[model samples]
Target: MNVSITGLTKEYGKKKALDAITMQLEGNKIYGLLGRNGAGKTTLMQILAGQVMPDGGEVLIGGQKPFENQAITESICLINESENFKKGMKIGDIFKFAGYFYPNWSLETAEKLLEEFSLDKKMKVKSLSKGMESALGITVGLASRSPITIFDEPYIGLDAAARSRFYDLLLEEYEVQERTFILSTHLIDEVSRLLEEVLIVSDGKLLMQKNADELREESFIVNGPRSDVSAFTAGKNVIHRKAFGSMEQAVLYGESKSDARKAGLNVEHVPVQELMVYLTEKTKGGVSA
Candidate 1:
């Protein structure tokens, strides 16, 4: 279930949502799709899940386009932030309908998740609260067991406890099923540990894509006297910097830990959230990473 996107482009009249983006994603891995608001995260996910069409380029799942294709659509399950369940449908009915469409659907998992989330099968879609609705959507995503499962900010109204449960369940299912999971969320720090790879988009362009571990390792923060920081950071890619009189702290890339130590500067690992903040900051009207 590998996914390949080549020169993908999309627009809405005068607004360009995506611009000639190209990337390949391997199956059976967890990916964190990261972007700021209006950065085309939703558009990209829609295009990948076959719910929308790209104006240019192609998206291939297992070497075939997903749009309007029964086989591919059935194999990919995308749970969005806001689910639109039938007004009159019950939780049981929704599960039953999903089981029919998904070849790998698991009734047992669905039932267990309902109990864990404290949702009743007899409950009508209209009666469930926001958190309950999100829980149901997550249940569908996990129980579907689709080869390509995508969750686009699916835990909107979930509380801390319920959200923790969802994370545990996701990892449990992934360990057993080994399916590809693409998680798009604003809670970067909370989910950073779960990501194997990361993709960042900004202003209709792909900014960066890298393995989570290597990205963190290669990204180091330097702090020391302002003069020492300035001398050490010369010729290096400076992602971010802050100065307060004689003290200074800077975020840099492509600079090794040994180099920082040799320059008599303090080096520390940058957290995923901080890294994203500095990497995505607007510079000269363009996002830099």
Candidate 2:
């Protein structure tokens, strides 16, 4: 489903968790909601899922407000990093509840995932390990078949293999069902390939929203002699720069890679993870990409 946010603001005591953030999320695409700790990624996802209300502005999902709206929220599933399920509940009961709560819940898919993750429905929530719990969360989030499914760092304790499996399943589901998936995770490099679009937030404010491919093509790293790099980067939007003796390297946004190469500097595409770090660095004052 399409999600629209307009001047969305949220505050807690003296802190503004979200500050006049405005963006639009198109339907049936994978989005990376990236930011550092306490950057308002969680708060923004909560508001979109109808779990939290904004102090100012609004969030519209599929042309309707999600806050306290059952019809709207029923199509949105948000799996948080932790505290997703009650410890007292059994796995079977949790699945049953999800079946009732989400109109598009698929028990068949859930059962298959349980088998793949080696989770037994008879087990109690408190008895599972952290990785198992995360697996369960992934199963529910995927099986819900919600039009807008948001996963906020949902693989907390999973090993590398398990995380890879989750990524495969997420992509498979997306290809088959074509739903909107907003993933808020710190593992940017791992998930970067799956992201069709990227939304970056910094200090509770919207920094930039751009197509992933375009961002990759526009932002790059250049390295060469200090004088050569400096001359090439002159008047350019350099988000980051460093010097190693006579050699220097600079990360630039919205610059032509071909032009940099012509200037005798080594040009390389910046990984999304590294690009995010440069864009949100405090020294840069959250420069927009």
Tell me the spans in candidate 1 whose CA falls farther than 4 Å from its real position.
284-289
Off by over 4 Å in 2: 285-289
- Candidate 2 residue 254 Cα shift, in angstroms, is 0.6
Residue 76, candidate 2: alpha-carbon lDDT: 94
- lDDT of all the models against the reference? 0.90, 0.93
RMSD of each: 1.6, 1.0
The sequence of per-residue lDDT tens digits that candidate 1 reaches over residues 1-289 is: 8999999999999999999999999999999999889999999988988999899999999999989988899999999898657768999999999999999999999999999999999999899889899999999999999999999998989988888888899999999899999999998888998999999898788888889988887888999999999999887788888999999998886568898999899999888777777777887222334
TM for candidate 1 is 0.96
| Candidate 2: 10-residue stretch with minimal lDDT | 280-289
